[model samples]
Target chain A: MEKLCRYETDRVGYVMVLPYIIFFLIFVGYPLFFSFILVFHKWNIISPMKFAGLYNFNFLLHDPLFWKSLRNTLIFLIIHIPLQIIVALVIANILNQKIIARGFFRASFFLPVVISGVVITILWQQFYSFETGLFNTILSRIGMTKIPWLINTKFAMPSIAIMATWKNVGLYIVLFLAGLQAIPSSIYEAADVDGATARQKFFYITIPMLNPTMIMVLILSTLGGFSLFIEPYVMTGGGPINSTLSCVLYIYKQAFYFNHMGYAATLAFTVAFIIMIVVIIQRKLFETEVYA
Target chain B: MKRIIFYILLLIATLIFVYPFIWMTTASLRPEREISYLSPLSRNFSFGSYITVFKRIPIVRAFLNSLIVSSSITISVLIFSSMIGYALSRLKFKGRELIFMVILFTMMIPFQITLIPLYVLMVKLGWTDTYQALIVPGMISAFGILLFRQYFKAFPKSIIDAARVDGCSDFGILYRIIWPNSIPALVTVGIITFMNTWNNVLWPLVVIRKTSFMTMPQMVVLFTVGGQAEAQVGVQLASAMMLAIPIVIIYMIFQRHFIASMAHTGIKG
Candidate 1:
């Protein structure tokens, strides 16, 4: 009876996993393999695919617009990741304290994250409006000149990054709060006994202890920053001379707008490749810097 | 003294974070010409913008489409992921390790790389502009499977052994014995999946061109960005409010669960 049950269990295992395997193959496996094949061929959706060796890749190498979008993405990341870390960490540290209405504060901060990005983007687009936006209206009321937030190329990407930070910082705050909780109260007690000042404890003990969480925040923010499409799409349409055009937006335009499937595939592959390299380098640098 | 300072600073942060939303709520009620005034104290307020939005688009249908797509995908993900999770965690099967590794591999490949081919496949299958375009591709997630597998591993195997010895079928054991007891995993996966699908704009934008099939976010974005609500800032904000309010209600009701599950998952839509 045990032997018979063992065989049935094994068969059941196959049955259970089979659905996912089929879904995986149809949705994930085939798409992935097709994407690989697409990189080496030239085809619009309406046309039969013609093999083109490395032409798409060669074109991508020299595509100035593609390079510009990549530069824009890097700029957004540079501004976003640091701002996100500082804001999230500071708020998290503050919330980690024994305070009044901590729940209310946390919920308020996290509200934007749960809402649709499209909605937030639309709201901020209006807020960043050049003429009558709230920021500029306040500026004008204070006897100052109104600065264009999203209209100018120079201010556009940075402005989006700030909005992105606002939307996402709450998540990181929760993460950092969790990390803050994990640090033993005993360490702080030890520091107190040693006559350590608050600033000294924060810099010397808290910062070092929070290294793992900091690395995680860094990675998650990087991945999040790379997926910057909706904000720029809704707000700028990658305009103001393509200043805020993101990597994904560029690929979307290529694939859908121009119907350059093969070339877009090449760009997609290249961006994905770049993201992997950047993430791997980040891990190595942060791990060695902190651990060493 | 320090606590007072912290409180003041937090109050400032709260205003900065929550003030825009407050402004949006008030502005959506203000007349279109008075939108720039930016004060809740303004005398003029009406339901004109909300009515305009309803006149402009089929919002009720779009809401239902979003509801149907999100809930169906969430339920499907919960069932399929747990089943695979059970198999991977408890049962011994050939290629189990390989399957686990394959799912991990899929998780690493960003959705952008495969997007074009996936679109082409959708086109070839004649699924574009259909509900299948939105629902089918997202029915199973690599992350969901891995999350379930990790959760199921911690579940005690002695109970599984006992159930098996008691002549419970594998499906019976999973559905009756394991799943009922695994509420945390189920809720985490379900909420995240539903929220992601609800807020998703890109895939729906890519696949569904028909107005009848547009999801709520997609419909709102297109309506606002496509210039239908041009010069009608109040109407645009009204449409946005309609999109945001449902998610906000859900988040408020399940505030603790939403935060805990999102933080735990570390996966954002």
Candidate 2:
């Protein structure tokens, strides 16, 4: 009886996971493998794929637009990640206090996150409009000149980064809040016994203890930053000299607009490779620095 | 004094996040000329823009398309991922660990890596511009599968054993027994999948060329970029509000789940 039951269980298990196995192969596995094969072949949709030995990679090496998009993504991340961490941490810290209506406050911050990115982009684009925007209207009300938020090359990426942070910081806030709550109250009591200042307690006890959460926020932010597409695609169309072009957005254009499938595949692979390297470096730096 | 300051600071931060939606709502209601006005009280709001938006595009149809696509993706993910999760968590089958690792590896490879090939595959299969293109690739979320696996791992083994002793089939056990006790996990996965699909713009943008098939976000984006609402700023904002309203309503009802979902998965697409 036991042997028969074991055999039936095994069969049932295989049957259960069968659909996923097939689905993964067709949807994920094959495409992942096909992406590699596509890198060395030039094929427009209507034509037969022609072998182009390293030609796609060679073009990628010299692609100015690709380089610019990479730079823009980095700039966006540079602004976005730090701002996200600080703001989210601060808000999370505040919300951790026994404040009245904390739920309302947390929900308010997370409101933008749930709303579609396209809606936020359109709303912010209007707010960032130079002449007749709400931001500019308030600026003029205060007798200050309107700052061009989206159009100016210097401000465009930063503006989008700020909006993106506002849209996403709520998520990290919740993360940080969870990390904050998980800290044993005894630790704070010990610091209190030592006559530690609040600042000292925050830096010494809070920050170090939240290392894992910090690393999580960093990685999530990095991944989110790399996939920065919809905001720029809608807001500026990677516009005003491609100042806001993201790697994903650029790849979309190359593959879909221009039909450079091989080149686009190469760009996608390179970005994926860079992301992996960066994530690994981050894990190493964070893991070693805090532990050591 | 410090407490008052803290309250004030929190209020200001909340304002920064919450005020935009309020502004959008009011702006959409205002006439085009008054849209740039800072004060909602500065003008008599009207529904002219909303009327114009409805007249200008098949927004109702777009909403239905978004509903169909999102619900189909969500349901499929729920059903498929739960089954895989049950097998991987409970069943001691050969290659189970290997399959789990493969799913994990699939999660790491960014979606852009497969975007071009997937599009080409769709073209080859003549699935482009159809619901299949929008729905098929998203049918099985590896994240959802992992989430369910983690949830099921903690499920009581005694109950599962009892169910098997009672001659309940594996599928029957899953649907009748394991699932009834896993509402939180089901809601989390369902909401996350639905939200991601509903808000997705990139995939639909890649595949769906016909306006009739375009999802809400894609349609609204085109409505904005194609200069359809050009010179009618109020009308543009109205369209954006329509895109946001349904998701906002869902968020309002499932506010806790939204936060928990993100904190649980941390895999916002």
Candidate 3:
């Protein structure tokens, strides 16, 4: 009788999951398989696909623009990851205190996170304008020569990095704040009794305790860094000599603009592979920290 | 003295984060030539830019399209994910753990990898430029499934058992009992899904070629970047503000829940 009842429940479970399973198979499973097959074929949407084994990957390997985009993305990660950590950590530490109107501060900080990326990019485009932009205007008023923020290639990627950091630092702050709250008050009290200064307490107790959240922020931001698209797409159109062209934007242009579907698929897979490897390394590091 | 210094620093940081938004709003209201005046309190406030934005784009239609797409996605995710969550948590099923693992694994694969194939699939299905292309692929989210599953697992099983014992069917037990008690999870998933879908630009950009079918972000990006409104800075700012204000207002009303929901998801926007 128990066996029969178990069978009946199993049947019901499958029925309940049927819709989700079908949708997932159609949307996710099929596309995943198709994306892989696309890497082996050469076809624009206009013509029938012809098998071109390894040609797309071969082109990707030698493409200067491809290399440039990868380099640009790495530059983005280098600038973004550290800036995100320091700013988020400092602000989070501040908000963790008994500051006045803490809720208002938190909300204001996170305001941009809720806005559309396209909107934020456009707003910043105006700010990064060469002559009449707010930043340039402020510089001139302060007796400093105005600098071209977006037009000049030297400052373009860094300018984007700064805007992205401003847009997203609030999220890491919240994450860090949560991590900070999770640390027991007794630990801080013990540090106080030991006559530890504020700096010592932060480096010794707070940073050590918040290791897991820090790792999580690192992984998420690294993944986000790889998926950099909208900022460059809206801000510069990956231009001023493609200094700000991101890996994903490169893939987007290949497929949509240039109609090299196979090559685009190859680039997309390369990005996914790189992200997976990075995330795996980060996770391994996290595990080692936990074990150590 | 230290506390005063801290407060001053905090005030400066807050202004750095918030001043651009205030500037954007005020600039939108200013005359085109005075848009970059640096003072947010320009004397030449006008509705001219807004009028231009409305005239250029089918702003209302795009807004409605975004509404339809986002709400449809949110509602479907809520129902289907809850159902899957309930089944995975409550029911005795074969390959349950394997199925759950599959769902979790799918979340790791970035959407870019699937973009080309999915676009091709949409084209083959005659879905490009239609609402179906925008709506169908995103109807069920892996993240939503995981969230609901975690929430439902913590819920007391006794209520579901009682409903089952009282001759309720599986669907009935879920709707009548589990759902009523799962408001927090529903709201969290709903808000996150809604915001993501509403703010989604890249996929919609690929699929929706026509301006009439475009979502707000897609429309705004095209308008500015395509040089349609590039000459008029005020109009561009006004279009961006139009795209941003709704979500910002929603965030203000549900600020606490929004923060909680994002923190819970562990994914930063």
Candidate 4:
């Protein structure tokens, strides 16, 4: 009777979790396995599958557009991650002070974070417009020349980077604020007693204490940087000479637009692999600094 | 002097962060000729652009579709995740540890890696342009399950034991005894899941080809990019506002819970 009761409860437990497990299998598990298999075969929606062995990988290796997309993504990270950290840190430091209407200020900053990416992208696209954009209007009023923000290739990626920074900096500010608050006041007090200047205290105490949050921000920013799609898609369509084509967007176009299923899957796997490697390296670099 | 400078800087930062949205709303109310003006106080404040937006796209239908998809996904995630969470945390079941590990492993895999094959799978199932395509794949989140499992693990075991002694089944104990106490967790998961599903663009962009079935974000993107609303900057901004206003209102009311939940989940934006 004891064994039977135990089995009955076990069955109930399995039954309780059964729905999710099945959903996971159908949605996550099957796709994961199929993506791997897809890397070795060519099959558009209408066509039959043909085993294509290492051709997709070889083609990707030789594809200049793939390299360009990878390079563009790196350029985005190079600009965006540092800009995000600096801007977020400065804003967080300011907001951390005992200021009037601090809650109101924080909410105002975070308002953009809650808005959808597509909305932000569209809003900024108009602001970046050459003819009658807000930025150019302001520029011309100040006796400056009107520069095409999105239409110009040299300025397109950085313009997008600036908008992205504005859109996401608030989340990092919140993170940094939490980290700043968590640092005990006694440390600052001791530094004061030692006659440490504000700049000295910031460098020696504040920066060091913020190391962990900085690392987390770095990793998340890097991952987000890799996933750049909707911004360029809405703003530029990866154009003005394809200067803004990101890896994910390229994979998307290849699969849906160009109907190269095998190649797109291969590119997706490569990007995922690259993300893992980059995240591991980032952790090692920052984690060592934290420990030191 | 320093305090004065700080206040000045704060005001400027606030304006910089907030001015575009103010501009977007005002521009949407302006005529085409006046839409380019930076000032929010415009003489051409009218609903003409909004009317044009409504005529160009099925905004109401798209909004309803988004509502249905997000609500369905959120409800299912709450029910199924809580069930699995309770099972993992409270039950003495075989293979529980292994299952938990699998769920955690799934959380680490980026959705981009699974995009292609999942699209193919949906096509094979003939689910394209259907709500099932948009809603089914996201019915349960691994992160939601983990979050609830952590919450449920901390609940007192004595109460659950007493309920069992009173001839309560496990399901009854969960539905009756546990869920009421887990309201905070439910709200956190519910808000996060709802916002994500509501704002999700890429998946719906891939699956739903027809305009009638598009979610708010997807419709807004399509309409603004190259659709009939493209040339009309006022109409485009109006469409963008339509997507943003509802979320902004929700955030205003639930700002505290939203921030707390974000902090708990460690999700950025």
Give the TM-score, chain B only, in order for the candidates: 0.97, 0.98, 0.98, 0.97
The digit string of per-residue lDDT tens for model 2 on A1-292 reads 7647684457778998899889888988888899989999998878899999999999998999999998998999999999999999989998998889888998998888888899998998899899888899999999999998988999999999999998999988999999899899998998899999999999998999889889998998888888999999988999878999999999999998899898899999999999999999999888534431
Which has the better DockQ: candidate 1, or candidate 4? 1
Say what the RMSD of model 2 is.
1.6
lDDT of 1 by residue, A178-268 (tens): 8889889998999999999999999988888888888888888888777888999899999889999999999999988999999999999
Q: How do all the candidates rank in terms of TM-score, highest first?
A: 2, 3, 1, 4
The best candidate in terms of lDDT: 2
**Which stretch of 10 consecutive residues in model 1 chain B shows the poorest summed lDDT?**
B33-42
* Residue B203, candidate 2: C-alpha displacement in angstroms: 0.4
**Per-prediction TM-score to the true structure, in the order listed:** 0.97, 0.98, 0.97, 0.96
True contacts kept of each: 0.74, 0.77, 0.79, 0.69
Runs in model 1 deviating more than 4 A are: A2-9, A288-292
Which pairs clash inside model 3? none
Could you tell me how far off, in angstroms, the CA of residue A42 lies in candidate 1 after the best superposition?
1.6
Q: Given candidate 4, what's the lDDT at residue A253?
A: 98
Candidate 2: clashing pairs of residues: none
What range of 10 consecutive residues in model 4 chain B has the weakest lDDT sum?
B260-269
Residue lDDT tens for model 2, B143-220: 989999999999999998888788888899899999999999999999999999999998999999998999999999
